[model samples]
Target: MGQLMGFLNIEKKNQKERDPRKRIGDWNEYREAMPEKEVREQAARCMDCGTPYCQIGTVLNKGTSGCPIHNLIPEWNDLVYRGLWREAYDRLAKTNNFPEFTSKACPAPCEGSCTAGFVSDPVSIKSIERSIIDRAFAEGWVVPKPPLRRTDKKIAVIGSGPAGMACADQLNKIGHNVTVFERSDRAGGLLMYGIPSMKIEKDVVDRRVHLLEAEGVVFKTGVDIGKDITEEEIRKDFDAVVLCTGAGKHRDVSIEGRDLEGISPAMEYLTASNRHLLYGEPLKPDFDAKGKRVIVIGGGDTGEDCVATAIRQGCKSVVQFGKHGRLPENRSESNPWPENPHVFSVDYAYEEAEELFGTDPREYYVETKKFTGDASGHVRSLLTGSFKSEAEEEKKWDADLVLIAIGFQGAEDRLFEDFGIEKDPSGRVIQADDRSYQTSSEGVFAAGDARRGATLIVWAIEEGRKAAAAVDLYLDRKLSLLQN
Candidate 1:
């Protein structure tokens, strides 16, 4: 390493972020950029630990720390510090096809496992990562490298979400003619529509989509496989099929006045909000919170997002309900360091809500019982019951816009029957095998949330890449270079 004592010489610097007052008014990304020089200095902080567990990607400290996908963190960090931009990009692309996405949205488990964090702040891994990839795009280094030879085989990927996209990208690189079928008007299932623009910009997703298109991958939008096209046609036309649709069908609140016009699922609301941004118009079955009193019923990231969105829509007031009690401000014994802490997050959304409402809008240890709607069939307020782990029942709230933020059970499986594939009892499409992702029927494969249930985007990407590897092996036993 260039400077063994560099850690002591320079203090870590975080990226510049947007002003809380200004960013809260809209739904765009709030983080600002770090100066190039400052980011390189942060790179100097890596001590080059012997094991470098930050990149090894295994659980540490009892579900607290560790990276996933095992990035070559040190190698890229050194390259970035030396100003070897292209080399840094190459090192990054070795494992991750879309560092830009992870850099923006991922919570950065690698930093949690960082050894430098023991004494003070961890190295600016996420910031540096975003810098390298963004530079790669700017420098025009991210070109489409199509396979040298074409294979006679064809592959059909269901659900154009992250897993499907990753799988399609990898398989196409290995010479297969891959086609992605998305039911939506766009190709990127969640990435294109489900995720709000504030978190991940549309242009970034479009750029990747353009590259995939130029690389000869076919994206067929507005086509539902089980409905518009028959499964038999898909099965007969392609050598294999992969599923990457997300866990989107939400759990409904079965209670009095559920049919109230203003009560809606979190995804339905978020999806409409995103659609409005993309299409420059309103959506059918839209759930706009403008001038309404909003109460979001759930504690996770989804709930936080709703609060932010409500504020943007000019909701009069907003509150987020956490079914369980609040988490500790810092890591606890059960959720120790390096295992990814279950602590409070002052995310941009929360920051915005606090600035506008004059207080943090989160309400812990609460649950909703039902809604009371106006005579016009619109939500007026919520009747709620509170219980944390069945220990006690207390607390309630009055709400006008009742948003159910409970999690999803599985994929939109309306199309599952057409493929003749088996599904688990929970409605997750059954993969052909654990080691091999093929379905019960020959030439059909599954991956990502459609197969494994709803999960992180990183995990979806991993599932897509691994399934592609398996499918590539299945097609040509000759063994292409990088089978996972």
Candidate 2:
């Protein structure tokens, strides 16, 4: 702790966000920079706790907390505190392959469990991470450094989402030739498509992709293993195969008017915006919420993103429904210090809606029953419900566009059938031990979302690293096959 008493002494500071009124006119990112000096001062606030629970990254006792990747939080915190910006960046890159993504997108379970946060505000760990990584990139510190040795072995990874990218990057780092296959036109999967530029800029993703390409990872776009190329082809050519296909199959309300026009899943809506950025494609006509009274059902991160997107698109009004009750502002008696806190949070989308709509747009304790469409079958309104429990129900609301943000089922099943891979009953995830990350099929392994279902980007990176190690071992044991 360079400053020793810095947690108690310095006031907490975060980056400045864009002016709500002006930012809604376009899709640029909302956050502004904290001055470099101020960022260092904030970094000085980490307590460097002897036992940092922040890195534990999970919830326990219905309230477990800790970093899943077990990031070297304290080391980087000290490095930043000492004004070792480049050194801090190096320390960060040692564990996280893409701090820029997680710094912007993660929910920050690390902060919830921060030791200083028990009584005072937690150190802005995410902000510090972003600063270090951004500085590194500007300084040419981020470059292509290929592995020292080539295995003469190759791997095929399906899905260009975080999990697949993580697997491919790690495998390439360890001297294995890696080819990433993506069903979409571009390679980044969701980050390249599902997330809008307002949340994560497209150039940032492209820069990393460019770096990975320079580092010997091969990317093949517009290629679906089950369709364009057969699973048998992949099995025969590659030394090993890894599945990172995401759980992108949407979960719909499946009500009476679901098939009607103007009722859509959140991914469809967001993907349209991303595709436009990537290729300048015409917008997905079905999803424009402009000048309409929009209702988003489901109050998770996706719903918040929708509220923000709608506001930017000039929606007349927008409201989101939360089936769960509002969380408390602070931890309850049961939730003590150094734990992952799950109190209430107001994200960018909610704040943007508040600026335009004159109130928080979330309607808690509400549910949607069905869609009410006009005779021509475009959605005229939503058949709604208000429920405190399973037995209670109330219905109807006037809405022009209804976006269902209810989350996902699992990975698209075609990859499993194509690869003849096995999955657990929940449709989540193929079962694999933490160390090996292997699938039931021989010479095929799974990682990230395909192995663990939906999860954080940081976890996906860690899993990729572990799988790289496992693949290394798998290759060493089968050198005869590699000679072919």
Candidate 3:
């Protein structure tokens, strides 16, 4: 819309990254800032289709298609193309509470469904989005605006992750007194710990949290809600409670030599590394990958994170195993337009590992059969077999450290039981109405990974906003009854 045939003229250019070899030596963000001029040109490539599928956040064929938070992609792109950065930022802020987090961390499902992508490369939406927010912050357009008035009602949010933070932010903006409880020593649960600093620096998360604090949202770190304060006490102290504890129960690979000392869960490894980086804590011997041969089991974002972390820790050698075969170079028949394309591209971790190790670290179509450890009960090597072959052909790889990055099952079970909340059949998540976000226990609501299973941060933020709206309605009804 900004320029006719702009998509054809302007080549798609993404944000540049720091040299992988140099970046792996330090714990810092990899992406370099894009220049404003280039960003505007990228924005001009937006086709501004009649039916913009990029903004239509929905699931198709079990894959997310567009922006889950329903960001106004086209409007912001046009604004950016016209050099109205402040307006673009305002438009972006209307839907996405934290573009900084999502721009850096999200997979950018919106780009996948872009109309330009069907014919040519998609608009550099992610880079443009990042630029808008970064410019806004630099220009001091982002400032704390607390509610004009206060309501008597108080709400408690149980986590400080994206969902919990979004819920608390919205509730506070609506004049409710919101207090967020985080079990960690610092705020930003997974954002602070589960993810490595290279992906999203801790200060980025802290900046937003500090702004929220200035806006009158109370964050109580180092508070374990179920243990330090009882559920009964929470219900009595606050009018409503929203649980945003993410699905953190990690999935395990039960195999031979499972009790070996060097085998650790992916979260534990990532969390330990991050804590050491941020707080200057010493890493546990098993989590430290220095001068050791590392093998990452399972393939996903978490697994890639592990690979990158190991490279940074100076691992002697590294390899990743995946049960599934490699994805096609281009989209296949099953993966059509407007759906997240199931295509393969080199990710940051792969690029970094290859740069350091002189070869790609991934081994596809491989299944771990068992582990063979040393006499000292430390893992020494692992045996793997072909994942799809009729006859299991086994191969052994020496490894001093093994990381299990399979995925998470759901939220922890004990917390829900202690709160007297009903859980679904799997007992992994709180049983809550999909639309209402209210749990079986009245006055208690659940959102994010606790209600739904483990999902994208964008989805979690959306759920948090929705849950806040639902809680607001429920509180209004309660107040009305009391008045009557």
Task: Report lDDT (Cα) of residue 309, candidate 2.
Answer: 82
Pull out the clashing pairs in model 1.
57-67, 63-339, 64-338, 64-339, 64-340, 65-338, 65-339, 432-438
Tell me each candidate's TM-score. 0.93, 0.96, 0.99
TM-score of 1: 0.93
Clashes per model (N, Cα, C within 3 A): 8, 13, 0
> lDDT tens string, model 1, 368-430?
777777788877777767675555554445667878888888877667766677788776877
Error of 1 at 431 (Å): 4.6
Candidate 2 lowest-lDDT run of ten: 57-66
Model 3, CA-based lDDT: 0.92
- The per-model lDDT (C-alpha) reads 0.80, 0.81, 0.92
TM-score of 2: 0.96
Q: Best candidate per TM-score, number?
A: 3
* Rank list by lDDT: 3, 2, 1
User: What's model 3's lDDT at 473?
Assistant: 96
Quote the lDDT for 449 in model 3: 88
Tens-digit lDDT track for model 2 on 231-293? 888988998988888778888886788888887899899888667656778765467877899
lDDT, residue 58, model 2: 65
